[model samples]
Target chain A: MATNLTGKTIVITGATSGIGLATAEELTRRGAHVIGVGRSVGRCRAAEERLAALNPAARPAFCTADLALQSEVRRLAGEIRGLLAARGPAALDGLVNNAGTFTYWLALTTEGFETQWAVNYLAPFLLTHELLPLLAAAPTARIVTVSSESHAHTSLRWADIQLRRRYNGLLAYQQTKLADILFTAELNRRLRGQAPHVHAFAADPGLVDTPIGQKGTPELVQWVWQRRRDAGIPPAKAAQGIIALLDEGLAPRPDTVYWRHGQPRQPSRQAQDAAAAQRLWALSEQMCGTNNGSLS
Target chain B: MKSYVLITGATGGLGKAFAVECASRGWPLYLTDLRPEPLELLAGALHRTYGVPVRWRACDLTDAGQRTALCEALRSEQARFGGLINVAGGDHEGLFCEQTSAQLRSIVRLNIEATIEMTHALLRLRDASETFRIVNVASLAAFYPMPYKATYAASKRFLLDFSLALRQELAGQGVTVTALCPAGLPTTPACIAAIEAQGVMGQLTTQNTGAAAAGTLDAALAGKAVYIPGLLNRLLRALGGLVPPTVVAWFIGRRWGAARRDLGNPAESSILVPEASPA
Candidate 1:
């Protein structure tokens, strides 16, 4: 059954390119009002224009922001709020935290966190926290963060969550992916009692060929990616797995919130560690300086 | 028709100095920053201390809506502004590739975008009868191509060139624009720390913020196009002109890169950007 998302507004970060862009196209094709975010102004404008042209019915608006910065994320929430407010008190129905990055060399946001940590893990955490009110305002809302199967093996170092000392590009990326599922599970747990209608989910976008791996990488990494990309699936296929989480007909399992290819899968033991999720959540609160010990 | 000089980034080190200097001279002020409580405290202190008419409202200048709301508030009040000081600016010190694109965009937004938009808006809001003095807080690095501070320096250079060009464009229309280029002044704790990290070089170039504010204001009032505060800074600017920009960039890259490493985590303290004035 092809359900209509005619009046629903969904906000997706990093919608200008790669899986984010492909997901945006899928959302638009479904007749949803998409509010997309990108870092570069030119790219945002271009993406908005392209999306508009592709689907005349899809009124996709793009906001330019650097999700790596907390201040920018706060501003983005306000901008999205203002955008939705302008459209007759219509609350946001969905939030897709699909923006992820893989940097070979370590970089830092203005907020002094590792770039991958900031963009991949922290951006989603902060953006969701900031936009939770809007999510609650809806009849029912869903929060879908794009996690990875890379989350399976890796574990977060509680001592140095950011890996400030012995930084490895792959390790840092994997740690953030781990943090994503943990964050999603913890956020879902918190929202269950309070705003039960607003559910949280994690999508394991299985190794789609995207430019995320190619950008700002070492020459060796680029050489490997050139060959590795052939084995990966298309971004549109991965996008379906993400969008499936937002489907109303798709009944969720009480025990399984992690989905891949539209099917519930048991995450790693580390991802299922309730105590670890609680610890990571508390630590993230401190790092983000977010006073949302409880839902705002 | 009591007119007031509006200062952006009112709670910052140099911004606070500008506010204090203006108040001491009996210039009524309209201040704006990112936080409300601090603005209230500063306004109260300024009014109590200097016995000057001080008013403040907190605004995030980066947001166009907030800026418009602030301007609309001013317009509703029928407030007049005698001078405008663009003191709200931001910087991120690191290698270009090593910094997030968001940091790079922020430098452009705060340094270039906010300044230009505010100037355009406030110029329309200016009291035509009074001489509207415009002071843009550019840096000494504006003259050169910087490396680790590439984005910041480029933004400042944009301000420098823009201020000069705009000054000419608005010359006979009762507005005089001045670009204040200072080397180093202890404007914020982070700034002071960053300077201290430069060792003897920081000490040699650093000056009093109060004096910089005072001198720059005087220079602006006198219709000077540019004001470099310290004598050493002035001399250094002149001497730096002798070297090729490529060489200057390489030298600065090495020096500032080393200094940045010494400073450790740049943002562990507070947000460096001063959420400057709005309306």
Candidate 2:
């Protein structure tokens, strides 16, 4: 049966480019009303135009917010919640927590957390928690987080959580990706028992030639991948993998990792580790400046 | 209205199983492999048993020219390939140091390069009208780094990552890409020998070709981007939390190292351990 995406409202972060933009386009084309969250007004406007061009019948709303900043991420959630609340209960269908940062150089967000962990993991953590009411309003809501293959190598450092002691851009990225996996796993665990209507999933784009990889003045990894574009899969295909999980009929599996090719790859061991996931969840709550009660 | 299915690595044990299963499903077949005799026999057996159309091509997928030629042949035959099962891939059982430049190139060429080329070609030909599906045979080794099978693990990692990205990119395009990551499937002679030699026959589950392919195909259609063939594999994959890859690699390498010694090759020798990410 064809998925009934009509009348479904989906909010996608990082919808300005690559997988996020492609997913927005695909979802709109499938007849869903998309509300795009991008950092820049210009980029958001451009995305709005693209959405209009792709599916003129589906006029997607655009909101500008720097996802790396907690205040902005919070405001975006409030704005989305307000928008959905205005439309009555069960207005939104999904939220694609796709916006993320890959800092090549060691940097910290204004919140004092590592930039990658803050943007890729914590922002979504706080944003989703804050918008739980709006998500719950919907009959069936899906939260899709775009993670990375780098997570396979990540080992969560409890003492030096931010990698402040010893830092490498790739390593930090991997840790955050691991955090995303752990976050999704815990999210699903909580959702399965408490919120059956809400389903959580994680998707990775593989080794796409994205700007996130072209970090630190493009000298580091550009040559490695530029030489291998033909070998690497495209971003458009990766977006489809994310959407498959959002499909209405997609089976609800906790701790599932969706690959770009539409199959559920096994997540890194940390993702499926319930004890680790719980610890990570607790840590994430602390990092996001939220109390344990918020998620509970 | 005949439906045609494509199988790469049709000569291998697992690939042959997919061929047999698809033929049993009453689909006409387009099979490719490096060896001619096995490919011919697999096709003949399928044709004789299922009474379905079967086309066999012996082409080294590592060679781009040969892969392209095979794809062109399938296209020219007016075969609207419904599904593509990339089964033609294997590991060179050696340490990273033992792998010659040529051997490393062959591993990359056969496992990663062939998969990317074939999938890209099929993606170009696919549309919503066709029930398009892609199944890339990756290894659980793709999950993490293995000291013994470094290149093979990296290649599988590349496939797993690519499969995740491609699945999302092709959504609504009506094509599904599946990466099958299985560990220690005692389907072939090589696998059985390796299991016994390692005494991991206790730890490993010997899944035959038919069962593995069935699981692969079923998961692929269900839009599963990565499918580990067995329940134990799935459980271990989820164990990523408690264990780290470094630790797993250390333990696995030690065990395989001992096994290699029993095989008359000491710890100094090469062992092809398919990398499974720490879980």
Candidate 3:
């Protein structure tokens, strides 16, 4: 555990399990007060017990919000803001946008966005926007969006970003990862000069052995994932890179915000394409209307 | 004095929808429920969102003394009622012998006693200048004898029969009584889970709280006595009425038993439908 974590408060979505959970545990172990979030109360309660058992003095708490809905995301942001304000400073040191999904079939959330697109991409976008005031209040803050190397395989489908016209589960997932990197780049570019202390970075938690593959997939896909995951590293190892990005004191280079192996790395050509990043931001803003007046 | 539609259970899923629906229709509202905080929150939000005159207080409708206190507060304010939506009812779903005596008593007290007492109290306070409209939320399960939900079904049956009988008495007296016998309402989290546990059938029969509230109001204001929301739910009710109640009980027993297993809280699970001003 690091000695520099005292008095810091972090928020981690999907912190109930997998990489997010590991990151939350690591952060708590270092003496930071963590607010872990899960999709359901039962899951959050279970996660709370596990964290309490590991670090009783950590005094961690969990909140439940369904990330698939933008309404829920906005509400969660407001809730965290209220909670932080009541505590005193109303500042946020870190936000881990790690909650995600992988579904074999195309399903739409109540708001009509594709489930994967809604959970993986839109949630992070809206949540970050909603929490900008709190993030801005911190002397220095970090936003780590968990992207994947799979982002290299695909570019944004501008015609149908939600994939209503054509759908493949793996491809859809890869596209969200691509969108995440693009979003990080766009956000970093926007933050320069205005709020240079609040850096945005994408952490590639490379193929950790977790249950991301088996859920909502066909039996054959599950069988294949079971074999493939046997060779992958544990979530703790993957979580370290994300933690490093969050803990890094210095500001990152604006153009290179993607992190891997605790070092800055360049994303795919499409991810780094400023034109595409701007386009994606505009579309996302249109889809989920911007609540905050400032969105450069 | 201006008349405000008095809604019980103003914080629960269905009750909130009723509050929103009434406010959307420009009806001044007097909302009551168990908790002062949530009641205050919802009332403030409704007044802000819909720009309607929304007044609220906390009252445990099941307690006669509390109900009397609530009426007295209304009386002191010179509150007149042109509408009353009785949405404050609850259920404890499990085997009759398994549920605690207190739980069983709560189902009867809340679903029957509280509703009847509120109805009588509000009838006297109705605004004589405008026609009064009343909607009593019953369940489609009222038509059958359910095995697991024997007590709940019987209570809803009472509301259904009581509403119809009251309608006959109030006919041509510038007041209309409506029985809202909905099959399943996707109002609260627990109810949504229960509906999902039933698979495709649950998905089909269940109605959204906002839409149901709006449509039920439309039907009630048009003087429709019995308004069951969905065509399929109404079909199920009509078809269910043809079968002997004994057979219906066995079928519902098997169906709910399966849903309970899917729910996976085996020791003893109680669900609250969350309507009415049981604050």
Candidate 4:
């Protein structure tokens, strides 16, 4: 775990707290220069200050971006590209698509799409695609997406992807998780064996206690807290799995699915469905407005 | 020549249940699994009970080469394949990092690799104008990352997605691919172990394996991409997803981790594993 990240520049979305913040601290401690992305400037500044205090002034910088909005995510992507261009080629070592929000109530993003799906799926989709050049500029770059096991329940409804007809927050979140795996699989398929080196890996940080769960209510959040406290494994250990994927070169099959505990997890039914992958790819191209090829 | 439904993992708990459901319907059977003795015994019993011809193929499905050879042999036998159900699989109990490479590889090969190969082989044999069915048994664990049974869940998720996509691609091609997502069935060893592992062995009786299989087959034939076996599962599947990944992952990971530890407690085993006769 003691590897030098000294000159390495890392980008992480959702850096305000929980896994994102914890990862920021860990990466900064390991000598990497991290650019923390969060929605609130105050929280971002606070996190940056905390990191500085922990690192004794050797802290990664902070960038404020609301990943829920495509425009904002696009801007963040550009900013990252600019930073890397200035830092020189292969300066960017890793990108963590960790920023996401889930609402018990159905909400819409600035893009007019469902909030959870847009923030969790669409935003990452766009940001990753837009900054691909910067990712490619680097000799070997790693893109670690945080997905979930909840994705098993999600069925891709091509006809009504937004859940406009029948909206359920949980189902929508699962849809996005399923999308994460599909996107990862497609990305790996496109990478064709060149991963972490040429953009490889995505991980699901199996349940850990984090502030993101408290968005609903204090009581609800406490319930979440107690459940996690009762059943929760250490987030640090789960984070180790993400670190493992980044450090230990991904297996021969990056397109193959894995869980945060460093176990090989099955992807959602949709991830393996080639026909659905094809359909989803076409739809995602339309949604993200990019032309990456199909997984078939 | 009578048409036959070939099933893998046909000797175990869920597989045996599926076999009974199919046999009762007068479907000729072609069953395979690693446990040759029990599989053969089940095959003989089913044949005698139903008066339907039964053929048992013994092979480790995780071995791709052996699975290929088995498929070729089945094709050579000119078996009129009507449907193929992939029900054979097992789980490794341990922390993800502690899991041996062989354990992870074996589960992946059996659940994902073997199923994929078997589906392709049988799809190749289906008559152009005749509708054929392929049922890939997946689990509710696939719905999300399992902190405990991580790899097994991910494999099921892959199958769930693969089955749906294949179903769509094969649309109008006379081949239907349906993935069955069953949660907490008490009929098999794996199910019992999973239930015991979760500290909710009593809640394991949500649906019988035979009923779940019939429901899954019905959904597959009707062209539904995925068939979640129970109402409660469908609801939980619908709920508990509104929060962010890190949040849900944290909650689930913690809960499952604790449950895994509980399941590991030898005293809890009595409450977890149900003693049952093979249906």
Top candidate on TM-score is: 3
Q: How close is candidate 4 to the true structure, as a TM-score?
A: 0.48
Worst 10 residues of 2 chain A by lDDT: A104-113
Docking tier of model 1: it is incorrect
Model 2: TM-score for chain B: 0.89
Superposed by TM-score, candidate 3 places the C-alpha of residue B122 at a distance from the truth, in angstroms, of 2.4
What TM-score would each prediction reach against the true structure? 0.54, 0.50, 0.62, 0.48
Better of 1 and 4 by lDDT: 1
Computed on C-alphas against the true complex, the DockQ of each candidate is 0.02, 0.01, 0.03, 0.01
Candidate 4 lDDT, tens digit per residue, B1-279?
Answer: 147888997766567666766775688888987767766656765665456788988988878888988988998988778888998776665566766787778878888898989888887776545578788888776667666666777888799889878888888877888887777665544444445455433343255454576677668668777888767778777775565656766677786666656656332121212112110
Q: Where's the lowest-lDDT run of ten residues in candidate 2 chain B?
A: B270-279
Shift of residue B129 alpha carbon in model 4, Å: 46
lDDT of 3 by residue, B1-279 (tens): 147999997777677767767876789999988888777756665565456798988998878799889888888888899999999898875678889888888888888988898899889989999889999988887777877778888998999999999999999898899998887765544665676677778757866565577789999889988998778888888888899988988888888877778888545555454531110
Give candidate 2 misplaced runs (Cα > 4 Å).
A225-230, A252-260, B1-279
Q: Model 1's lDDT to the true fold?
A: 0.79
lDDT of 2 by residue, B175-254 (tens): 88999888765443344445556554423443434567767878887888888866777777788537888897887688
Looking at model 3, the pairs that clash are B8-B276, B8-B277, B9-B276, B9-B277, B33-B279, B34-B279, B87-B275, B87-B276, B88-B275, B88-B276
Total backbone collisions for each predicted model: 3, 44, 10, 27
For residues A3-50, write the lDDT of model 2, one tens digit per residue.
Answer: 577768998999999788988999889888899999899999988998
> Which residue segments of model 4 deviate by more than 4 Å?
A1-6, A56-59, A193-196, A217-230, A248-255, A292-296, B1-279
State candidate 3's TM-score: 0.62
Candidate with best lDDT: 3
Question: On residues A54-131, what C-alpha lDDT tens digit does candidate 3 reach at each position?
Answer: 777777888889999777897898889887877898999899999989866555454435678989999999888888
